[model samples]
Target chain A: MRFAGRVAVSLYLLVVSLGLAVGQRSLEVCSGCEFTSLHAAVQQAAPGDRILVRGGVYREGRLLVDKPLSLLGENWPVLDGGGEVEILTITADDVQVRGFVFQNSGVSHIEDLAALKADNVSGCVVEGNRFSNNFFAIYLAGSEHCSVRNNEVTGAATSEAFSGNAIHLWNSSSIRVEGNHLSGHRDGIYLEFVQDSSVTDNISEDHLRYGLHFMFSSGNEFRRNTFQRSGAGVAVMYSKETVMVNNRFADNWGSAAYGLLLKEINDSTVADNTFFRNTVAIYSDGSNRIEVTGNEFLRNGHAVRLLATSMSMHFTHNTFTGNTFDVTTTTSRSYNDFAENYWDNYRGFDLDRDNIGDVPYRPVRLFSMTVENYPQTMILLRSPLEQFLDYAERLLPVFTPRAIEDDRPVIGKP
Target chain B: MNEAVKVMKYGFFDLLRSRWIFVYTVFFLLITGGLLTFGGDPNQAVLSALNLVLLVIPLVSLMLGLSYYYYTRDFVELILTQPVSRPAVFLGHYAGIALPLALSFLIGTGLPFAVYRAGNETDAPVVFSLLLAGLLVNLVFSALAFWIGLANEERVRALVIALGVWLGLTMVYDGLLMGFIVLMQSYPIERSLIALSLLNPIDLSRIVVLLQLDIAALLGYTGAVFQRFIGTAWGVAMSLSSLVVWIVLPLLLALRTFRRKDF
Candidate 1:
């Protein structure tokens, strides 16, 4: 009797495994389908089911995915907004939407409506979708473990006031935004009150405002992205424990444009980035506990501008070349630590052959210091005699920011 | 003088007659007005509008110049058969196309500013300078288009080459400059600034105008350097000289090339 029971149990297990393998069904929803709408098909879809939408202009209202289902579009299917509301709304777990074009979202300054809205969802994937002329492209609010990748968001941002972001995340955590092209929006990507999110390998250009703007967001890692010809490259504010690495911030030239602006941030790591030809490479205000390393600052208007309140940041292993100003500080009492940086303006000797300077290199210039004291001193920056004065001042540091010195300066470019 | 005025008048009327040009002008006006009304700060709004106008006007001017030259290849041929010099014809056609377009640009760009009253009083000079700079840009591109049209007998080839030149100037030149700077970082060759600044027309314009804004501090370290070298009256003189060089040298080269060509 025991042998018979064991054999029966084995047979039951085999049957269950087979059922699990073949139980997942695929539902085909075409333009000529009886349901005729993506929302209708989604409402009818069961757990572990697939809804394949064929090529057609589907004037679907906001598609609320409230079930564990896959909604796939074939041949570049378009979801028209019909001038009413958002295109897709995801409120369920384990949802996937791919390969569709979402367009024509209603403009609203009060509400942050997006072409694709992912809210309170976990393990969701949104990929290979094209969003054009939308108020906001992809918005994640209070969502977790979500991935938005390989999407194109193009906006006709006439003004910063009327237009919204291409991709915006608020109060969301553990989100990944990767491999996307975002252009011509107020901001290409914006993060607010978010934590533990990562944005990587995205190209954001031609925006009216910042290419990437993050406020009160912490524990986020931004890497391998390119911000070109935007109003500003990126703005990180009021956050802690973040990492920015290996990004190219270039050609973002304007009156107030900066490659990166760090404001009130603490305990962040910024490394291995290239800031090329921007108005300002890095502008820091009241930021602290940050480690900046292995970055190249090239041909920017100002490489680094540290404000009075900035404190406790470690800047090392960075190369500052061809910038208008290598370093500028408003006050002499900054707690920031500068060491092991390769300043193009460094004129100290390296007699020891250890790639370290024999004497401490003061990154601040006397002219810059004068500007700090009296703003009008900048009027003499390019005068023929000013060069002699600068050389004299560099030979013997005077009136420069007191605390603005780089110890252990590198002989070679970092 | 009368003939030149007549030529200008005819060119204006001819542009007005083209449906595509009218349509494009209308489209530009609508878009520029809409953007200025809705976008962020008044300064940024004006800047953005100017940027669009600068980018689009050149392309339009290039295309119009190219097509005008192509369609009126016979007219040019007839004028050449007469007692008129090729240079006069070239200059006449250039001034004719440029003046009207400049006026239209002023109208299209200026009308929005009047309607919105968005920008500050300080912004007026920059705005005016921006418009004038854009007109210069139009002239530069139109001359380039004319040169291309003259150099290449085939209309398609001329159009293609003109577009290529535009792309090279606007995008590829910057990319190359970045690459060069990265490659040559070790040397104290910051002296190359003078030569490099002269090569690109856009940089010349930016340096000259940006210096006038007196916001050099906002521009990273390079702005300080620029302020040092080129921030004063002498710097402005240098910038103006470079601009003149950019304008005249290219035209001279084009003229020589055109005169020598078998076509």
Candidate 2:
């Protein structure tokens, strides 16, 4: 009697396993279909179901998902918020939101609103979406193991009083944000308390404030990002162990603007970056132990302005060309190490043909020091008298700090 | 007066024969035209062209001064010994040299930029400012050259002195001014720098044109002092008058020296 009971239990287990394999369902949500909106589709969906929302202007104001499902849209189905609230809100884990258009999140003074808001959920995916004229297009709050990819976020904010960030990440870990085109926002992408995340292949431009503003974020990486023409300035502040690679910073010109601003950040490696046409390319303050290598600074007002507090920076194999001033510092320049850089202002020759200039290249112009002290004396720039003074300063250095010399300035562009 | 015009007409034709006029005209044509054709935007073209104007205008003006005085010594001596009086000969010669230089500059820049402009309104003002600034610099330098040439006895000495003044004003004066600022970094230098810029015609012309080109706006500094420097009508009037002074003062000094000096 015991042997017969075991055989029956084994047969029951086999039947249940077969049912689980064939239980995955794909439900359609269209204007004419049974499940008309994403809300109705989510209500009927079980775990691991795929909800396909078809193309149309869906005035579905706010949607909530409680179960694990893939919410896919075909042909960018419009999710209009009606200027009142967020269009989509995800509350469950393992959720996917893709190929949708988000527009018109209401201006809020109290709450931090977003078009696609993900809260406290893990393994959420937001990708291939277009965002326009919205406040905080992709807001990831306390979410982990998520990815936001290939999204177009654009808006012109008249003022910072009511504007919001394009991608605002808060208290999130292991998020991957890549291939996004962002412009005209208060900030293109902002991160606070985010760790172990990577942002790559983003083109951010024309912001009233900053291209990328990160604060208190640690252990993050930025690669292949282009930031251009941001007005207020771009800053990386209070961060640790960050890596910035192959990024381009261009054309941020203002009295207070800089291409890349580093404040109180430590243990970072900024490599293969290009900075062009900024009033000040890199303004670093209180940042220590940063390795800046293989970068190009071209046609800027001041290539690098190292404020008084920075220390222990290593700049190697960088090219400085056509900048008004290569390196300007308020205090003496012993805080950093420079090596093997190429400067257009370098008037040295190599006798032995080693491709290394025989004389050390001095990068600081005395006029830059004057400008730093006065800021109003910039009218003397490019004057023949200033050029002569710069020539004289190189021979017998007086006003320029002595420690800002590149001993191994290469003869040719690196 | 008719005799003055006759001398002026003859002097104009004589200057037209010289190679300097063609080269001057061609240089302006190529630079302005090249910038317009390739420099992406009209504002950028103007900015690039300003550097050329500041450097080239003074150098060429000095060269023309030395050549006009030394190479044409025989002609001037012949005209002076004729029925022509001092004013007609001297003033007619001055007009002959100045008018051609100014006209060539105008045609060289004007033709190219007009061809490339496509009737854009904003571009016209920028080009106009550049043309006006070039003319101002040219006239000032030409006048200075005339004075230097008139003061010295030896032709070689006068030529050397004129070139020296060009170098000193363009290079050494600026150097000394820069060194002074560096040495006195503690004191206020803004008002002084503005005052110092007024002392050099090239510097003054540069600032006037650069202000019109909106370089301050390009650099994103909308400061009150910068705006007040060239923003108000009073500021405009002041700079224009200063430019006129640069033109008139040197010419008057040349006339005084020429009237008394023996050939």
Candidate 3:
């Protein structure tokens, strides 16, 4: 009798869930409904149940979705955390959380709390969420095969240290992060130990720190993203097999600002990017085995500032115009390759009509090295004394790096 | 000619012993020396010195020209009666003040740069350009002041025009240029703007100093034409010669006016 009863209960549960999957039952969540809160609805519903949250302010501490349910908001339901914890926490696989407004996830010294925190979940969709006053907007940790898209996050961070990244992904694989607009965060998007992810068509600007802080992320591709007016634009550190293509970075001007800072990054491709009006467009520090091609640097202080530790870098088909110094380095010996780039400073004529100039273009200026060695000399910029010294150095290779030259310089803009 | 030489020799010696020359020389030495020592950067010192050249040099030149001419009016009349020609008195008196002004400027700026840039080969060009700029400013403005002095015998009008020219070149001209740029931003204003900056001596000297520094921020405004013009051996030749023209044109006018004036 006991065995028969257990079998009947199992069959009943299986049939109900299968019915929910085939024709999902809608659980209405509102003040008039039986389930007034999203948390209550989510708790009452089984796997594959759809919860329709109505438009109203829900003072929920943390709305946890433990089952594979679809929680959709109508007319943008507000989920306020009351300045304590994350608003939404998704711990189940195949969960969908969309069209919600999240606010007031309080700051913590040790714990990094977010508006929507998804952990160890796969095949989830978190989309069209508007987040404000949250420490972090969306944080995906130990999750894979998830998509975070079309989210707009504007965080309130008065101080740099108390803030968090807008879209923070860690230890994730095969995720799609796209079409997100982020501002006023420490970092727009930060990815660490993330693999095979694609971040595309995102606009990240006006942050206190970097727009995109990528570290220890491999085989990731970010394309057509606009990162402007951040502290240092984008910082890709200790990452390999990353491709940055067609990104626009501009107007990040400060004493130590760079449009794209590549530090200890290896086997990366920086292609077709536009860097305009930055203090330093591309600052490479101990980075190696990277291909920089078809990029445009305009009106930057120093378009490319390479360190002595950088090696095996190949830059080709790039256009450098209106930049103060196209390429500046601390060392006199070069370990990088720069060829087929168009430099406005190049004075050589293409007498053979081959499109390439006969004379090599030297991008590293002696004054750059002098300023690097003696930073105070920057104040003497454009003075007759400075110009004379640079002229003399260019005439005769005295102290400038003799090897840093573009041999196949294109005659015009490339 | 001998009487003119006697007058020039006496006037030169007299000005050399004056307290104003000592004060001017000491002022230059203090500023240049302070910049070289406390400014922390030779480039910074050069920039400050460029500003000094633009403002102080012109003022000093005009003052020296006006005061010396006013005080020596009776002497000039006496020399004219003592068989000295009009051109000789004008040329000798002009040289008497101009040479000493140039000398004081050279000593005042050159001393600091020499002491600071001693054996520092990299800084030599900076020092040379700075001193050259100062010396050129002295020559151009002093020569200009002599002409103004010759044209206008009245002290107030001469001083007003001198100050006016100085203000016009340094501040008002730049203001007008900036306004024009804003008004015609859509046009290809780079080439025309480069040409415009060349019309003013202050602007030209500033350009020379900027080209020397090779700093991207300041050089960015000059555009490609300026880069091509200021970055080569020919650019330096052209700019320095332009400075010469600034001196010669004004001096010739002053000499002509002085030669024709009936006292």
Candidate 4:
């Protein structure tokens, strides 16, 4: 009786597998095939069906997939939008788009015209796609559990007035934007009202505006990303509980540029990042309770420009070398805390061999204070007089911010 | 012109062989080379060289010009006894001393950079600007030294004056300028600060180079004012002309004294 029951269960499982195999079909869409157009192929394709698109230009105006399907491009099939319409729009969950070149989407002011867009979709995967000169490259609106991986998005945007973001996420959560190379957009990756996303291993360069701009986005973690030569660099505003780690911000130098601008950001942690040659490595305004630790700041203008409005901010275990000013502040009273950070300008000694300087190091120079008050006094930069003033100010706490000293400054690279 | 060139040639040959010039050149080479090897970035190497150049080059050129003028007084007198005009003798001796000093600075700081292939197209301009600033500093300070030499009869007094001028320009003048600016902080002193900073050649050269090195730092409010003034083509032209004037005025004054002074 037991052997008979086991045989019946095995037969039932086999029958169910056969039914699924019969239901799910693989369709080929090529120039010589019956379904030449991707729009028709996606229409005919049922849920859980896989459509293989061959190497050919599919000038389908708009290919909207309303059902769950997998579209795999064999030889990087071109989905040319002809500069008049959106290329691929996914409306259903569990849709996967892989190995396609989406190009020349229509430019619009009222609507975002993306090469590939997902609306209210979940568990969608956009992988190994190349996007060129689209108004918006890969856009996700109200999407959850979506992943945009290993995509290359390049635009020739000149001005911010007409350009859109390369990868834009709106009201999306649990999204992963990883291993993407983006350039020449207004912003490389833009997150507005997004939450619980992870942006990792992305190289964003030469954008007209911010490289990674997110506002009202919370609990998003960014790691191992590089942002360079953008107009305003990376800006995190009106956000809380954001964590950025192992990222590099480089060469973002201009009148309005900053390596990282934390505006009204709270309870965030910035760790193990590198900032090089930026105008201002980190500019904090009205930020509170942020921990910046284990970072490297090299050759920047102002390593950290902390405003008086920032409260309870901690800077620790960071190495700052070759920067013009290690720290500059707007007020003489500092509410921020800087401890155990290695500053190259620190002149104190470590007689105890504890690797911490016995004498507290002051990062705010007198000249910086003077320049703060008198903006025209920047002409006196690197002057011996200013150097002397700063040296003297170090000896005596006169005009510099006394509260801005690092009590236990590190001796060498941390 | 012929007499001046001849005099310059004699002075140039004499100073070029001196140990001071060799040491100056070697000093630059070692610093620049060391920075390139260990500093990692060529532009950063140039930046380190800039501080040393700004501080040392002016003092070296000033002292070198003054002492050369003082020690070579007998030779200059002998030259003056020739058919050469006083202005020619003065100008030629000035060129002779200035050229060698400038050459030493160029070879010292420039050789290591060339070997390293230091800067790309973007960084090349910065390096070039730094070198230019050093050259201008050399010219301006030496001219001030020559004027002091002609004005003071006693070598000791001339040396003291030369040292004083160097100190004032390099250190004290900016202090005074700061004091002035602070006193007038309530007023709109961007234009005035520009005018006042132009008065000191060291401050002027420092500002010009600072504009290039710390432009990002300078793009803030006051820095923006300077960027507008010295960072623009017009501002650069203005500062360049001002530097030229700083070089010319001292020499012209010395020229007048050289023509009229007794042996």
Clashes of each: 17, 2, 11, 2
A16-129: candidate 2 lDDT, tens digit per residue? 777577676889988998788878888898988889989988887777787788988898888888887877788889999888889888778898888888999999998899
lDDT by residue for model 1 (A250-367), tens = 9887766888999998898999999987877888998988889989987676788898888888898899876657888888777888888898767789887999998888877766
Using DockQ, give the best candidate's number. 4
TM-scores, in order shown? 0.62, 0.79, 0.64, 0.91
What does DockQ come to for candidate 2? 0.26
lDDT of 4 by residue, A57-149 (tens): 989799899999999999989999998899999999999999999999988888998999999999999999999999899999999999999
Please provide, for model 3 over A1-414, each residue's C-alpha lDDT reduced to its tens digit, 9 standing for 90 to 100.
999999999999999888866877799999998788777788788788889988999997877888899889889989998889888888999999888899998788888888999999999998998999899889999999999999989988767889999999999999999999999999999999999999999999989889999899999999999999987678889989999999999977654567999999999999999998787799999999999999998878889989999999999999997677789888888799999999977878998999999989898887677667644334335434455566787778678877999999999664
Note the DockQ of each predicted structure. 0.05, 0.26, 0.06, 0.50
lDDT of each: 0.77, 0.82, 0.83, 0.88
Name the regions of candidate 3 deviating beyond 4 angstroms: A1-23, B1-263
lDDT value for model 4: 0.88
Name the runs in model 1 displaced over 4 angstroms. A1-23, A373-380, B1-263
Rank the candidate models, highest TM-score first: 4, 2, 3, 1
Give candidate 4 regions above 4 Å deviation.
Answer: A1-20, B17-48, B85-87, B111-126, B152-157, B183-188, B220-225, B228-238, B256-263
lDDT of 1 by residue, B1-263 (tens): 55546556767688778776667667667876887766533454554555554457668878888898787667656666777655666666667776666667777777776667644575677666666666666677767777778788888888888888766665565555545545665554344755675677665555555564434535333445545565457867777677777667667777786556554
Tell me, what's the RMSD of every candidate? 18.9, 7.1, 17.3, 3.7
